[model samples]
Target chain A: MPVTENIYEPVKAKLTNIIDESPLIKTLVLVPEKEFSFKTGEFIELTLNGIGEAPFTPSSSPLVKDKLEITVMKAGYVTGKIHQLNIGDVVGIRGPFGKGYPLEKFYGKEVLIVGGGCGFAPIRSLLYKLIAEKEKFKKVIFCYGSKTPKDCIYKTLFKELRNIEKFQVLRSVDMADEPWDETIGVVTVLLDQIKIDINNSLAIVCGPPVMMKFGTIRLLEMGYRETDIYLSMEKNMSCGLGKCGHCMLGDYLVCKDGPVFTYNEIKGLPDIWR
Target chain B: MEITVESLKKITFFKEFDSVTIEKILKISELQEFDVEEKIFDEHQKLIDIFVLLEGKVILGINVPGKGKINLGTIHPGQLFSWSALFPPSISTAYAFADVPVKVLSIKASKIQELVGDNDTFGYKFMKIIGQTLSKRLSDTRFQLINMASV
Candidate 1:
């Protein structure tokens, strides 16, 4: 593959809309000056000009080239600053780094998606791809968990997903508040309630560290193969390119080689869940 | 609701039990239903029957002095609740209520105790399942505690 000459340069993008997902998370819609396309699970470096840049997986569908959507959680200084920006502010976007979810491998198989918190961002993108090519897969099961009902992002998307044929959306809140009618437990518990043929299914997990660890363990117990379990790992990725050692997971660079990897690929790596 | 061995076999908790054992358990169990928000048991209340959720959701909570009812976890179908009845003291650890219209297989704790005492194999298998359930709940509670502390 040929590399782009201006790998360091960023294309300008105008923030078009902001959707307040939760108290601490927001989804920013941006219209890039140039058509930008990325695969479902790829990560992009979003620069706030002089403030700083952070890596985020686009929450919008990869098919939408004219614009991108990034879901942001107010976790640190850069994100806190990003949260303060209003509509019409311009931001810089660099490379659509890392290998993405392999859509072809998922064809003719059941797709099980387990996500929590802001991890729903990338999974949402993948969901869009799956929905567009719904005939390719046998079934899709999404199990999501949040701290509470108020903390759940993409609340409206669940209803939309449920309407799609061969798609099942199940949600759980670690704690419950009034007017909430769904399962209440950790996200892994949803695994028990779902009936899937483990042999013909692919399990995808993206979440906070603790959840990712436990969710993987639960999937393993449910008879999912290590090679069939894919995890979206988040690391301190300073550079979207592999040159920066900031995002190294064992010998692999999370930014370049993967933000998406099968459990078989990373199980031996130390502190992967963290 | 009619209680059948076949239906009991469908539940994860009873799946390992033989038909004869399920029949024995069925003799000591009956189907019970609760309306939405109906309190099934309170913390410190003497538990007489252990329940396997047949359908709907159950919210387990603890009553704090000022916080009132603080829901800690949810019980899903095919899962067991109120295992305190199987142990000594037989008092509930947390209060449980119907999060929705709920159905459960209520098993008489004393009869289960009698069955366990009489059969060593049945006792071992039953205890093993209970142990697994407790282990899972412990991990879940630890996860919830970490989540609360972080928040």
Candidate 2:
């Protein structure tokens, strides 16, 4: 079903800071006047008036309600304009649309979160949520990859997340050069370093098309059932409410049917980017 | 893991075919490759074999008089297309082109008929797969038509 509603709620947030995640990507942390509550995998449509708007996942912990955060990669027109916005700038906020990861399922279950490049945003949110309630989950393993260390968003957060007692953070770069000492290759390669109890664990994947394609297959090979693999899809989501058809992945609309879907639910959908 | 006849036979539609029969069927099918932007099957072309896309994207297009080229839909991996010749009239109504470099396996229509003639069970299973393909394409066409009408 298409999302027929567009509830425009005004939110005033002071852009506390902007961290340059990479040359083309940045994270905007906003301390809103009021609390902004959202699930990790859900997204918000940020409006920039004349420049248009784009959909992004607020990568802040669900536990933190007074602040909002979004990691954005500068890809084309709208995101380019978004990159120009500075701290203290006011931006339009439209939604906390689409359901987040099945956090309830992860309770008492080991979870694997895999991501690549700027695709790491939503995965990071999932990671944070799991970490906030660490006692609930058995273990959390995060595997992330990017073209280079320079292009890795949330590069700093990796160190902090690794320091967490219950979390295992592994990172890789496609091609390594400058002073890099870590795993290298596609994100799937890191799957080798981490052990997954596929039967008892859930895998949440969000990344570029190529990354998810192989990641899903690898997870399946590791004995994870198709139903247990949750994929975060990326599409041209203009209206987070699913009014816009830009995010159509077969009969299902990515904005509504999912930004997050179980592999079994979407394996039959045609033209799935991942 | 091995895509052998045994594995093929496990698919619901291929359940009728035993290991030996499925092996024979695979022999008749040949892998074909198409370069990026290459035409796989043109509209009105006679269908000789059933094309199963194993990889890459295929663009299904139709020409409209007094208008221009219209993209009906696009097919990705695991999806099948160009089945127009499988039914009445036995001629393609739309063209199929490789939007990107593609790899596919083709089973000759004549060979399919032969296999079906020999084994009704195999025939029924094969027809089921074809029927599913046709149903999906019909729905996709309807969606395109609706989008066009709205335009």
Indicate which candidate wins on DockQ. Answer: 1
Please give, as one word, the docking class of candidate 2: incorrect
User: Stretches of candidate 2 above 4 Å error?
Assistant: A1-6, B1-151
Chain A of candidate 2 scores what in TM-score? Answer: 0.93
Q: In candidate 2, what are the lDDT values of residues A63-125, reduced to their tens digit?
A: 787888888888888898888899888877667788778789889998898887778888777
Q: Name the lDDT of candidate 2.
A: 0.75
TM-score each candidate.
Answer: 0.97, 0.62
Which digits, one per residue and each the tens of the lDDT, describe model 1 over residues A1-274?
1123588888899999999999999999999988898989998999998899999999999899999999999999999999998999999999788989998999999999999999999999999999999999999999999988999999999999999999999998887755678877789888888889899999999988888888898899889999999999977688888897999999999988899999999999898977
Clashing pairs in 2: none
Q: Please state the error at residue A105 of candidate 2 in Å.
A: 0.9
Number of the top lDDT candidate = 1
DockQ values of all predictions: 0.67, 0.02
